[model samples]
Target: MHRPACSSYLHQLRRRLLLLVLLSAISAAQGHADEFIYNSFSGADLSMDNQASVIDGLLRLSEGTDTKGHAFHTFPLDFSNNPIISSNTSSVPSFSTTFVFAIISDYDDLSTDGLAFVLSSTNKLFSSSAAQYLGLLNSETMGNESNHLLAIELDTIKNQEFGDIDSNHIGIDMNSLISNASKGAGYYTPDGEFKNLKLNSGEPMQVWVDYDSERTILNVTMAPLPSTKPNRPLLSIPYDLSSVLPNTRAYVGFSAAAGGIPTMHCILGWSFMNGEAAALNYSDLPLKSIQQLRAGRHTYKTIIIVCAVLLPTLGIAMIVSATIVKVRMMNRLSKSRTTDIEWEREYGPPSFTYKDLLAATSGFNDKMLLGRGGFGSVFRGVLHHSKQTVAIKRVSPESKQGMKEFMAEILILGHLRHRNLVQLIGYCRHKQQLLLVYDYMPNGSLDSYLHTQDHSTTNICWAQRFCIIKGIASGLFYLHEDWEQVVIHRDIKTSNVLLDGEMNARLGDFGLARSHDHGADAHTTRVAGTWGYIAPELARLGKATKATDVFAFGVLTMEVACGRRPIWVDGANGEPVALSDWVLAAWRGGSITDAVDTRLDDYVEEDIELVLKLGLLCSHPSPNARPCMRRVMQYLRSDAPLPADLQPDNLLRIGVSQELRMMSVERPMSCPATTITDLSKGR
Candidate 1:
């Protein structure tokens, strides 16, 4: 009887121990379900779109120029409840995420837009754009509260429109590209010292982001890879995510974009949890994968070097002899043929053979022609070697004036690089035909969208128009003040502003652009440019200056805002009404916003008023009264307030009244006699 009781007690104790072990295992499983760790994305479950790919176990967000990429977690996380929060507290869950990323670019000091860690309601961002938009939002959706988005951006480009602090920065974005709070990419040490880190250094770096629900605080920390997290966070802000994330479920992801620069954004490791994220092991990351990718580039460089050194000496001698023989034959044929070699040596841009250009353009077929202008016809071409689409402008062989314009474009655009400026790739000359190649703009000219009567093309919204206005201003600012020399864009109009694939404005047509040393007098004496865009001083003095460029920009601004050309015949009276005069009249009548593009039904009233008033100020008859491009940028960005004395009466007192009165009857007295007609046609 005593032995039976002892056995029964032992059985009861074993049953209780087994039940406790089962409970512990269940709790562990629940914890794992709420978190994830990806040492490498080789087999990780991720939703990718566009250019995003998993290459060599690395999660590459973007791989090439003018592309956007997105990668998101396969499952959504519930943010409605927090384990650490009390019943009366907010429902938004506290979370932490850590990731190691790298930005590799072909250039050492330059890169396109950067990447962002995003928490969005949906994983599909198909409508997002590349470049400064960063694949998170487009011009239409940016800054809208309905987005319900939260992002931490590591931006490598400084966009003034978004109020970026610098090129290398980490910002907290709430439903917009404009950051709520931003800091230079850096961290403070334990001893209260700050150190800067370059985001596009082509090296791996780690970032940590944590949110505390109780305190409603967000902390972001970063450090170079393989280093311990700094004690102090780089950016700490007191904000509630509950407002930005209205939905209970959110998908975490990464979005990146590249502009004209070739860049690669990659992520090596990632960890995220509802609470504190698990620490990532540096050694476990797939560092060797990206290393090998970089090594491949190095191998290509080595091959190029070896080829340069190992060229057969005998072969080189034979080639030199053949070149001498060919030159002798050409000399015997005609001395005039030697001018081609001299022209190539003087203008130091890459030269393409005539045969290659002919092949690229399919022998200049009519179907390949993009548009015809006064100077030349532009043809769309695909280069055989690179498979790159380019615009080839073939100058008219018989037109003596076309040669001057061709040389001007080559001398100016070949040496310039800016986001808003069309890039000149190379030049070619065969017989009497002059060829100039430029990066292709797919969306065509801004004039087509603004003034086209074709129902097929969609009307540009007010947001896109505003963006184009700012883009043109930024490019003009770069030309007038930022560049080494002062460049006066003699022709600044809707037709000259080309829209790229993303509809970003690129000021092209530099045939009339004149550059001079800073603070030196302009030597250009010819009064050139379209009729309405020509400045008053330019017509009288036959000189181009930065102020003249501003005047034309002002006219273009009002034209864009009002959705009318600078000069259009009034329907009622059949008399020509200048765009500037009409806008000024609207301002005087206390209905300036009414002059805005009628096609646009939705827009910020204040922005419309600001643009109209700024246009008038810039178009003032006296060049001295006009603000510089720098001040214009500040006014557009609202960094500085418009002048208190700026009014229609004040402008009238400054002689604009007389000028407009003169210009009201079809053509003004100051209009240049040699103004280019049909300037609105595509170039």
Candidate 2:
């Protein structure tokens, strides 16, 4: 009987052990089902579209100009059935994803387009377009709510239509090409300072995206490869995934496109899971893929080997060549040193060597030319010492009076420091050549976007235009009242206003700027400014003051709001009509809001009316009647209400009628006797 009992106990023990092992196996299987990892794409199960291919264990999304590519997982994943939470809730389950990527371009400081990490309801993006659309949507499908798509874009081009902040930035999108929220591509340091990152640097970087269902918050964090992830996220947006997607099942992948310039977008590794994603090992990633795309590493090694073999054989020849070259360089250096010393004695700004500027601008090649202005032509260059990109303005060599304007720019911009003011890096003088260096603005002048005839390029939206207006006002306020000396920007127009990499308005072209001590009258003897931007009193007085700058700003305000030049030829009868006069007529006709840009799809009517009315107020003919920059800021920021007496009839009584009559008769008004014949010629 005892033996029979022992046998039964042994059988029960064996059954219990088997059950435990089976449960552990199921748990492991579920974990494996919930996550996916790709250390290499050589033999990975993926669905690829045009231009997307896996070669040598690297995933290349786009490799040439005017190309679009898509790569998605072969199987869809259900996000609703998260192991950490129940599936009964309406909110989508939380998830995390991490990836490593690199963008390689042929040029160092320029790139055409970028890439995106996408999550879509459908596996294929058949209706996508290339270029600024990022291979995610087309004109017809963009902004469609029924698309059920979400994307995190790493953009390298500033597309005004979509309201991109700058060329290099990261943005979050939901069912539309326009990002709902965006930030410049950068990461925060441990001390909380921001450091900008160049997306097309051809160096591997890691990105982490985590969504918390409980808080409905999505955090995006990025850092260079081999470094631990930063604690602070680059962007944290509050949104619900359910609102962007019809269901919890979706395909995850990457999409990229190139525009007119050659660029290659690549992905090295990726991992995704319902919970935290598995950490990526930098050692295991294909970091050399970017270098290979640029020029094969083996090719570099071969060059190094050939140099090693030839160095000893050519030693005597190289010694003689070096001595001869050194003597010539010494002579050139002596002349440059003499010229620099003379400039330093006369000017307060720092100076750059002519040789350095030449190398920076590639000997001022035509391809590096940015634009020609009334005073000079600007070139994009990168300094060798700091690798900092700059804009070098080469003044016209034929102008005998160019020295005066060049000195004015140096004296004024050398000491001024403001976010809205263009920063003067230094100056270079070589014989008749006069070059002024400034921080490079990648987006170029504001007029290009506002007045371009190409309808193919999207117009800047109302929001961006309004922001630019406010920014210019703030800069003017600083110049007039906040600085040590009162500054009068003799020329304040759209062409003089440049946009930086982040699309912020920066007042440039200080060649015509003038400054005076507090409470001192401007002693300028010649009037200088664009046609319609010049104040009526300036032509008579031949003097520029803070009020004259205000007048120009007013015209600029109207130009930006109307999306027309300050002086444009009427399409109907070929008569030049001033922007301010046209806007004033609209106000008198009780259709002031109609003066807003028609290209704008949406706008706040109240804001539009306020801007129009304020512009007219500032453009008042009498200098004493025009509001100062301080008051103008108040009006723009809503800190103070506009004067109630500021009606069209009241304005007409205060010389608005005379001003309109003069503008109509003169068409493009003439400036007081000055050097520039047609102020708009070079622009």
In the order shown, the candidates' Cα RMSDs to the true structure are 9.1, 13.5
| Structural similarity to truth (TM-score) of each candidate | 0.65, 0.50
Candidate 1 C-alpha error for residue 515, in Å:
8.3
Clashes of 2: 0
Estimate every model's Cα lDDT from 0 to 1: 0.82, 0.81
Off by over 4 Å in 2: 1-342, 455-457, 571-573, 653-683
At residue 310, candidate 2 shows an lDDT of 56
Q: What's the C-alpha lDDT at position 515 in model 1?
A: 93
lDDT of 1 by residue, 1-683 (tens): 69999999999999999999999999887656559999989899899999999987799999766678999998888765467767545567888999999998765677878999999988999888787889999879999998888889999887756878878999999999999999999777789899899999878899999988888899999998888889889989988788888788889989999765567899999999988998998888989987876776567556644544443333455557577766565444443433543474456423577898999999999999999876779999998865779999999998776888889988887656577998777788877799998989999998888887853444788889889999999999989887767888898989889999999999998988889999898888877777667777776677888899999999888888888778755678755556788888888898888788877777889888889999988988789988999999999999999999998888845344346455445444433243223333322
What are the per-model numbers of colliding residue pairs? 0, 0
Please name the candidate that would achieve the greatest lDDT relative to the true structure: 1
lDDT per residue, candidate 2, 228-284, as tens digits?
Answer: 789999999888888887686888899999865568899999999888998876676
Local lDDT at 578 for model 2: 71
